[model samples]
Target chain A: MNSRVVISNIVRWVLLFFVQVFLLRNIGFYNLSAPFIYVLFVLALPFGIPNLLLYILAFGTGIVMDAFYDTLGVHATACAVLAFVRISFISVTVNRDGFDEPEPSLSGMGFKWFVLYSLLCIFFHHLVVFFLEAFRLNEIGYTLVRCLLSCIFTLFLVLLAQFIFYKRKSR
Target chain B: MRNLWIFLNRYNAFFFLIIFFVAGIILTVRNNAYQRSVTLNSTNGLVGAAYEHLNVVKRYLNLGMVNDSLAKENALLKTEILALRSIDSAKDVTVKDTLRNVQYTYLPAKVIKNSFTLRNNIITINKGRLDGIEPDMAVISPQQGVIGLVRDVSDHLATIRSLLHKDTRISVAIKKNNALGSLIWGDRNFDIRKAFVTDIPNHVKMSVGDTIVTSGAGEFPIGVPVGRVRKTNVSTGDNFLAAEITLFNDFSNLQYVYVIKNKYAAEQKALELNSKNDE
Candidate 1:
C-alpha cells in the first residue's frame, strides 16, 4: 500500500525466489517431499490488494518457478489455483477478524487462522503441482502421498519463515 | 447487451482464472510432448549462470570424491593402453582397417544441477551449443557408465533427461546373452538406484546379477554398462519379461559427465529419412 510496504514485498519476493531455487530445490526428503517456500510470498500478500492484481502476481511468481524447475506451466497453474483459493478464503474469513490487519501473516492474523490459511493454500498448490507433473491416473496413490508430504514440508518452512521475520501484532 | 456486459464484468476474475489456467496447461502439455522451446528452461543463460556459480561451491565440497574417480579412470585407461600396445608390437599391420573411422567423440562437461528424487528428473550440464552439444547426444559418467541423453541446449548450458524420468526409454541388452530389452525408470518405484528392463523375450534365460549394457540402437554406443539384473520374473500383463535392475550410476552424486558426439549421426539420419520418404 505504502512505499515501505511495496519495497519490503519486492525484497521478500526476491529472497523467497532465491531460497526456493537455490536452497530448497536441492533439499528433498528421500525423493518424495520437496518444500516450496516461495508460495509464502503469494500467501502473505496484503489484504487490500485487488483480486486481479493478486492473480497476476501469483502467476508471475509461479511462471518463474516453472522456469527454474523446468516444469514450464506446472507451478504457474498451481499458483493460480493458490491465488483463487487465497482470495475466496480471505473474503470468507477476514471479515470476522476485522479489516484493520494489513496482511494475512501469522503475526497479523493470529496463529490458528494463519495455519489453516497456509495449510489449505499449500495443499491445493501441491495437489495441482504433483498431479500435473505426474499426469497419470494409474499412479494416483503415489502422487497423493507425494503431494501430502510436500504440503506438510512447505507449510513447516513457511511457518518457520514467518516466525523468524514477522513481528507480533500489537494489541 | 447491457446485461451481458455487466455479467461479463462481474465474472471477470473467473475468466482470468480460466485464461491463466488454460495457458499453464498448454505449456505443460507442449513440454510433455518434448517440443518446448528453450527460452523458459534452465538452459537459459541467466538460470544456467546461477546454477554454474552454485556448482562452484558444490564441486568444491565434493572435490575429493571427484579426484579419486578421475584417478581411478586414468589408471584403467593406462592398463588398456598398455595391453593394446603389447598386442600391436607382437604383429605388423598387413591390411587396412575399415572400422577405424571415428564414430563417437566425448566432450567433458560439469553438471550444474541434477535431480533424481522427482519422477521426471532432469540434469543440467555446463556445456551447450557453443561446445557442440545437441539434443539426443549420449551422456556417460566416468565411474558409473550410461547417464542420459541430452534433451535441450542453450548457448552455454544443456539439460539431460536422465534415466530416472518416466518418459525415458533406452535400448539395452543382457551382456552375457545379447537378449535385447528397453531400460526405463519409475515403473513401480521412485527409487533412484533402481530401474526396469522390459520387452525381453520370455524364452531368454535370465538370472539375478546378469549384466545389462547399452545395445547401441539408440543414443548410446554399444556395450556401455547400464545396470545389473536385481530381480527376475517381475509380473507384467504382457508376455514380455520385465526384470528389475540396479543402475550403476549413482545419480544422486553425479558431478561430471561426458557428452558423446556421434560424428556420423547426421549422415545416418539423412539415409534413414530417405527410405521413409520413399515409403
Candidate 2:
C-alpha cells in the first residue's frame, strides 16, 4: 500500500525484464533451453493483492517482454495464466490467516516453505508457457526436457532474488 | 447487466486469462503472410538496433575469422581475374566456358541484429537500399549457403526474413535428381525441414548427404546451397518423400553476408507476367 513498496515492485519488475530479455535469453544451454524468470515478478507480489490488479500487472509485464523479444502475445498469455493460478496455489499451500499477510516475503515464511511455494509457482508457469509456445504433443519428450531445464534456472533465480531482497529482520 | 458486470469483476482474472488465451490461438492460426510481415517490421527495428551494437562487439572479437574468410574470397576472385585476362589474350573461342560465371553479386554487410528466439525470426543487415539491396534479394554467406531474403529495405538498413522464420518457404530441389520440394520450418525442436514433394520417380535413389539447393523457381537463383539431406523417409498415404535438411549456414553465428542481385530478374519477371496474361 505504501508508495515505497510500489516503487520497489516497479523497479524489480523492470530489472527482471532487462535480465530476461538481454542476458538470460542468450544463455540457452542448448536449443531446447528457455528459462521464464519473469514469473518471479508475479510470485513476489503481496499475498493479499487484488486478483484483478495482479492479472493486469502480469499482462502488462508480459507485453513489455513480448515487445522486446518480438513474440506478439505468447508472454502475455503465459503471464496471465500464472497470475490467475497464483491465488489457488497460495490457498492450497498456506493457511487462510497466513494468506492475509501483508506481503509474500520469504522471511515471513520459513526457507523450506518459501522454496516449495516458489518452486510450485515457477513450475506451473514454465509448464503452461513452454507447452503453449511449442503447441505440439509430438515433441512431448523435448518439451518436457525444456520445461525441467527452465524450471531449474527459474527456481534458482527466483530464490536468489528473494534471499537477496527480503532480508530477515532480527526479532 | 449489473449482475454481469459484478460477476465479471469478481472473476476478472479468469476472464482476462481467457481473452489472452484466445488471442494467442488466433495469432497461431491466422498467421497470414501480411500479419507476419507486420510483426517482422515491428521487431526488426528493435532487434536491428540491439544486434547492430552486438555486431560491433562480435566483429571485433571475430576479426581473425572474418579476415580469414575475406582473404579466401579475395584469393578466389584474383584467380578468376587472372583466368579472364589469359583468355582475353589467347583467342580461344571455347574460353567463354573458362570465364567465371558470376550469377550473383556479393555485397559485404554485417548482421546488425538477429532474432531466433521468436516464432518469426528476422535479421537486420547494415546494407540497405543505399547499397543496392532491395526487397526479395537473396542474402547468403560466403559459403554460398542461403541465409534469408531481404524483406524490407530502408535507406541504410534492411530486414531479412531469416530461413528460421515459420512463414518462410523457399523452393528447393535435391541436387542429384533435381526433384523440387518446399523448404519449411517444422517448428519442432527449431529444425528447418522440407515437405510437399509429391512426384518423384521411385527409381530415383535418395541417399543421406545429398545436397539440397534452391530450385530457382522464384527470385532465388539455382545452386544456392540450402542444406544437406539429414534423413529421408517416405510419407504415409502420399508418394512424396519427406527430407529433414540440416541447414548449411549457421544462422546464430552469421556476421558478414552478400545480397544477391540477379541481372535478368526483371526480364524473367516480365516474361512470366506476359505468360500469365496470355493464359
* Top candidate when judged by lDDT against the true structure: 1
Highest TM-score among the candidates is held by which one?
A: 1
> What TM-score does chain B alone reach in each candidate, compared with the true chain B?
0.66, 0.62
* lDDT (Cα, tens digit) per residue for candidate 2, span B1-279: 999999998767678778866765465335434445555676897889998999899779998787757845854673455345433343555656535544455567778997766667899988888888878887777655787789999999999998778777788888988988777765554643332233444556787889888888876767778788877774535666666667777776776776767655778889999999999
Per-model interface RMSD values are: 3.8, 4.4
lDDT of each: 0.85, 0.73
Model 1: runs farther than 4 Å from truth?
A96-98, A168-171, B34-279
Model 2 error, position B188 (Å): 42
Q: In candidate 2 chain A, where is summed lDDT lowest over 10 consecutive residues?
A: A96-105
- RMSD after CA superposition, every candidate: 23.0, 22.4
DockQ of 1: 0.26
RMSD of 1: 23.0
DockQ for every prediction shown: 0.26, 0.17
Which candidate has the highest DockQ of all?
Answer: 1
Docking tier of model 1: it is acceptable
Number of backbone-clashing residue pairs for each candidate, in the order shown: 0, 3
TM-score of chain A of 2: 0.89
